[model samples]
Target: MSPGTNVVIALAISSIVIVVISFRNKLVYRQRRELHGCEVPPSLPQLDPVFGLDLILSRFTSLKADRRNVSLLEQFRRHGNTFQSITFGRTTFFTIEPRNLQSVLSTDFLSWGVEPMRLFAFEPFIGKGIMCSDGAFWEHSRALIKPTFARTQIADLHLDDFGVHVERLIDLIPKDGSTFDLQPLFARLALDSSTEFLFGESVQTLAPDLTPSSAESFLEAYDYGQSCVGRRIQLPKFNFLTTDSRFWKSCQTAHEFVDQQIQKALLVTSKQKQDVDGRSRYILAQELLRQTHNLLDIRHQLLNIFLPAHEAIGVAMTNIFFNLARHPRIYTKLRNEILVADLKARTLTFERLKSLKYLQFVINETFRLNPTIGTNTRMALKDTILPTGGGPSGHGTSPILVRKGDSVVFGFYGLHRMPNVFGDDVDVFRPERWEKLRPAHWSYLPFGGGFRVCPGQQLALTEIGYCLVRMVQAFERVENRDPTMEFVEHYKITTESKNGAKVAMVPSHL
Candidate 1:
């Protein structure tokens, strides 16, 4: 009796265990399939297999040395646009064609949203400012802040102030042959321009006696914030412990510096209000802080305004100078334009500066060739179809289902350089392309697109333009110290050149 009963009980227990294990396995399989939109082709190879994990790891490690965007563009050419892969711990949807880019940015923008790290990485410093916020919060921030950018003050103040700073920079440069790294010079110019326009204070970053290392703490902290954000994408659990992280330490230093400046600005604005002609130029920061008492919110908006303004202008200026030194004809034409304008006034006024069409052309040309933000990222809010039709890669109109939570990377660098849109001279630094740009709403987005387009575009353009005009007027000859030097791209929020551009400047007789 005991033997028969024992054998039957053991068999029943084993059967139950087998059934439970099978059920658990099925659920796990379903979840993974759902994550990839369930429609991912079975034949589509894993990203690691195509681009070996070792190589991908190496690329990220040597980010400072590699021309990553250019290399990725080359890979897109070889693999074709619309390739599927995973890198930095998320699935990536890369496209180089205009049609595909338009579909992602304009036609089906609502389907995509910002990934977690992309939005929250700067939370320790910026909070949920417009740059990081999505949905309603983003809308509210946009409403409150966009008007400030739209104000005539932004246009008038920025151009005039930037021109003054550029003149100061020129006066400082030695008249005789002296070689210097123009990269840091441009960086300083950008930082000063942005700071003056945003906070009504000048750091005099471009002064000849001013050392770039003075702001090294702030720049390092800024870089740390970007790295932390990128790292968050791969390590979600790290968020809970970020305060103890080195990244957080760097962020704290940046926040403390900003807070001091903000407090100082507030005090000055208060004093200014006491005067009869009482006018405060720190309107952007003042208004933003007054509307929201949240410290993180204030920090976020401040950094949002500061970081992009610094990075985009810095990179664009570097590229412009690089291109000008490389192409003598373009440089000469640009200088001639500045010379003609200088004849009208000792100092270029904001209104007079706008008439320099060639300067604008050169800036636009640099943007096309070297976009500051190499890639645009968005997450799927719900399972939706991408409007992109099949390319040469045969990813046809089968309604590409994007599962909720998957990240879709709209490749801006790839799109900007696409042959179909920009033509055969795609890689060339030709400002003339913009003359024929015509109105292609979503196709060309250096400042991003849709509701999220940069509100600071006008300010950025003004700052860059003023600096360029002043530089041209000041220098009789600008020569590239390292014409053969290649720009190596590294990702830390905005793309930065690994080694700065070195150039020689000589004062003009005019």
Candidate 2:
């Protein structure tokens, strides 16, 4: 044999030996960490067909609901609560487990962060707002808005703007008995209220005789911009070839609408101080400017609050109304609950509203079945560990190893509907279940959990609950135009009825 050929063979053998030794060293280090309790348990069991055409196909297959979420639920049902996978070229860890949830979202929150992809996708509209940005920016943003979202401020809005919108909504309803998709009506109602609550000037979406309908374009822009953000996240981030001109157009429209509002608020604020109407119903922009004069910063924060607050609140009301339409029995039961409270008060206040237990149960039930923002997807900022699904040695109580750059997605619908946490009839909507089934905080996240929990949670609940109670108070009957309920495909922004929820209203003799 030639000396050159022998040298090449020798080099190949040496390379193989080096690889083997490196592998052995890594295995030994992992074992040492596990024994010393310095690290989480071994890696978790990965879900099959992890990231490829098959996974994508399964996700898009079900047109009945958010196919991606439906796919996640199917996997959880098959492979315990915590399962690891590779999705869109990134290592992803998904969990519906209570303990793991507490770790990822609360206890070890510093270890995990909001997926950067989300920040980039939403940056066009929300900018460096609290929802997408983290660290000092998130802290600063949270601090500035915290005071404005106080209970007293929320109560004032509920009592004033919210009540006004619902009254206009009643007038808009046709007594001619024709069924209309109530989702748009609810959106219009929510938009009108959110405008006054956030901007200090009602957009007058209801087109009342005294006011003109002016916000139609603004609402359209907001919806398109948000939905595009959802779509962008679903697409592969590394793919340079991908582009959406339409999404940018929507962004322009939304930015123009919001920017105009911000300028108007600034012009007004410059002239005179806003009246402190006891509860402080100052426009959010004015309150925001008190902390910073940066128009860009103000624009982002205001947009962040406006878009999701508008879309999510609207969807919540629509779904609750849709569900109530199907279950007239729940309507009557809730109305009775409201009437009993009615005798004790001249008008309902936030405190009085909180006292209505059954109303809360209904609200809880609605949020459980349809969490508007279903998944809480986060990324690992550093090498970390999840609390469970670490396989045999500890009966899955062992911690699961998570690598930096990996994603942790908390599917709310899957978690909330888990049989172990919520009981056997998890899929069924039973308001009474709130009576018997009480799960851990992380397990029952409707507006997320821990430090990153939704800031507008109280405000959203007040509006949704207050609207429903007042709705049932004014009208006796909520009849479904269709016998069955159907859900639209998920846009990642929020869910809606596939076909608008058609319903008929009948007055109850007051």
Candidate 3:
């Protein structure tokens, strides 16, 4: 009885183990097949390091200068528009040509969807925010928010509010002849402006008695969000488990702050009746809550607006200010234009600011040199062929087959700096180029292009323009304290100045 029972039990256990192992092997094989179908081109001459899995895992999360990324464009210059490789995880098709960009963004936008891995990384913090979401959800969110910025008349209101914020910033500038870090100051200003505009209340981030704890928490959350994305991309298996870990604790802090502010805005909006002019100026949170009774939808929309609204504006402003500090001539030109415009009206108004062509040029130039959103990625939702012109620099006429699920990275930095698009002096800070040549729309996409272009671009431009104008108007002379300030191009979300911009501001004579 013992021998028969023992033999039966042993055989059953072995059979179960075999089935499980076979199933596991099948899953792995399927995944490998899906990956290989993406059809990444053979490694280019320069892709010696990217081919190694160990090297990618080690250096993927590293913030050091990626010569590999940089060289993709250089290879394009030497070889043409299309280059190929598998980096990080998926097969990639990189394009710098305007025609290709237009095709990807405009003509066949649906075919090239947001990259799964990138979206997976971003989902933790931003959730399905309009920036990350696609398809119907994106359409719904965009429809709801589009009207807020669609009116031509709101331009004046935008500028006027921006001026008030700028005045607050000017007051905060130190007159002690002591050098101060402008990065934090610009960051605060951008944050304050975004909060005020989005929620109808200011965090007073730029105030003299800035609340250090709140600022630190905000920054910590932002950095945490950025790091979480990078970490998720590198380690997919541990994503959900690690999302709530200490690395993302600061994200919780940020969420709490955002929720509190949104709640406060809702309360205020609830109390107010539609004004005689139909202008009930309340926080976007309040406006959104009033319109939608659905709790889950409300939460999603709030998160969507808060994440991108706060950081995108901040990053854009930081880049613009960094450029202004580095190129004083551009600053001087911008200031003179503002001063002349301001004097003619006896006061600075939003309408008047639009006439300052040089200001627009400066903003455009900043975008060209240092885009706030540097990289865009897409996943092939279906088997598609991306038409390739040639190798990195080659003019070969060939259409590259991009299988479904392949990841495609559109290098905004590489495309913006392309000599064919921007001319040979692409690296130089020349606002005059905007006057001389009109760039193809996709070539200079700081706010991105096509179906998912940033909804807040107008507001961002207004806020940035106001800040630049006021800073230039208030300071007679501004000089960079750190002339050797290096650009930190490879941060998780934002490109930051490695050394915070230190500047000396001399008061202007009226």
Q: Listing every candidate in turn, what is its Cα RMSD in Å to the true structure after a full C-alpha superposition?
A: 5.4, 4.3, 5.7
Name the best candidate (by TM-score). Answer: 2
Error of 3 at 12 (Å): 22
Ranking by lDDT: 2, 1, 3
Judging by lDDT against the true structure, name the best candidate. Answer: 2
Of 2 and 3, the candidate ahead on lDDT is 2
Say which prediction, candidate 2 or candidate 3, comes out ahead on TM-score.
Answer: 2
Worst 10 residues of 2 by lDDT: 38-47
Q: What's the C-alpha lDDT at position 263 in model 3?
A: 71
- Candidate 1: the clashing residue pairs are 113-379, 126-300
For each candidate, what is the lDDT?
0.67, 0.74, 0.67
Cα deviation of 103 in candidate 2 (Å)? 1.4
| Model 1 misplacement above 4 A | 1-65, 86-91, 207-216, 227-246, 269-282, 343-354, 391-398, 435-439
Between which residue pairs do clashes occur in model 3? 76-392, 79-393, 79-394, 80-392, 80-393, 80-394, 199-283
Q: Rank the candidates by TM-score, best first.
A: 2, 3, 1
lDDT of 2 by residue, 109-205 (tens): 8888773757877887567788787778888888888878754655544566677788888888866667877888888888888777776677888
Instruction: Kindly indicate the candidate among 1 and 2 with the higher lDDT.
Output: 2
